[model samples]
Target: LIRGGRVELGDARDLPFTIKRSWARERLTPDVHPGGFVLGCNMTMHRDVAARIGYFDERFGAGGPLRSAEDTDYLVRAMLLGIAVEYVPDMTIFHHHGRRDRKAIEKLHRDYSLGNGGLCLKHVRH
Candidate 1:
């Protein structure tokens, strides 16, 4: 939408990637590596994983004060705890966000940036 066109999101974020399981399942701190992100709207996980991570941080949710990055925060938390986190392409959901205009998309980007900044600060503080 910010790019000035019809935002057909079918392939907007999905990209071909190769992920290798880390032999040493240990981490010094939480980090969002490449291929570690998944859309919150389409996020799916085993009940155990959810229970382990203690669920999404509402503070980072789109409607919350942070305004975005709940999914990324969840993923990073899982990784830091040594819980498996992967991006599964086959498991998909059709999200019709209807952001067909530049103004809407630009706003979305701005909101996302704000949320991302908050997320970073949260992690750094911890």
Candidate 2:
């Protein structure tokens, strides 16, 4: 797996959006360090790898009840199966959906938290 960049629509000074953008860029860029996990928006894999991994978990992501963490789940599984995941800084993508409001951002965080917990329970239990 290879991850890429995510540039937001607004100026860099835009509060939480700026912070989020910076965090993502720092993680995904090679200049800093290879990302700890793959983001769904910028993930890439060869057909063989995809076939071996069996693709993303349908139980997570936007339309699902969990609302996120599918990418993390997939990355975790791939790593467990001994796959190499890489972060590629040059492959950039622009993200326009930067939530400016506090409520929206909070909700996003909450959903991700819940999804992460669900992923852990589903995959980490003995």
Candidate 3:
């Protein structure tokens, strides 16, 4: 179990943003199981579990068209394999790459959608 957020590098004015605050709060008081989603930047897994799951998928991550959902795929596989996933609110990491502008945020959302669709096709197709 782990949690994390983005922090502006060397920017005193950049406080913890709304999304990060929401993530922290959600981690502290999860109304549902934390396995609903996996935050890749803030995730931790046991070595045994990682080995069993064979780690993250190589197709989905940053610097690719998929752009995300590798963490989602890993967590889904872990759950299917009967691994218990927990969220530790205290475990946090600062992500140096923060999207500050509207254009970047839009692109992120777009990429996330694409990655999510890809995940669905990979796991849910029958």
Please name the candidate that would achieve the greatest lDDT relative to the true structure.
2
Query: How well is each residue in 1-126 modelled by candidate 1, as lDDT tens digits?
Result: 000011124544532221222223322233434123455665566777678789578888767988777766776676667766544454444545656667777777787788778767866653
For candidate 2, the per-residue lDDT at 84 reads 68
Q: What is the TM-score of each candidate against the true structure?
A: 0.69, 0.74, 0.72
For candidate 1, the 10 contiguous residues with the lowest summed lDDT are: 1-10
- The local lDDT score (0 to 100) that residue 26 gets in candidate 1 is 28
Worst 10 residues of 2 by lDDT: 27-36
Per-residue lDDT of model 3, residues 6-71, tens digit only: 322334343333223233444322234332344666677667667888857878878656887777
Superior candidate under lDDT, 2 versus 3: 2
After superposition, which runs of candidate 1 have C-alpha atoms over 4 Å from their true positions? 1-36
| Candidates ranked by lDDT | 2, 3, 1
lDDT of 2: 0.63
Q: Which ranges of candidate 2 are over 4 A from the true structure? A: 6-36
Spell out the clash pairs found in candidate 3.
none
lDDT of each: 0.55, 0.63, 0.59
Each model's number of backbone clashes? 0, 0, 0
Question: Candidate 1, clashing residue pairs?
Answer: none
Worst 10 residues of 3 by lDDT: 27-36
Best by TM-score: 2
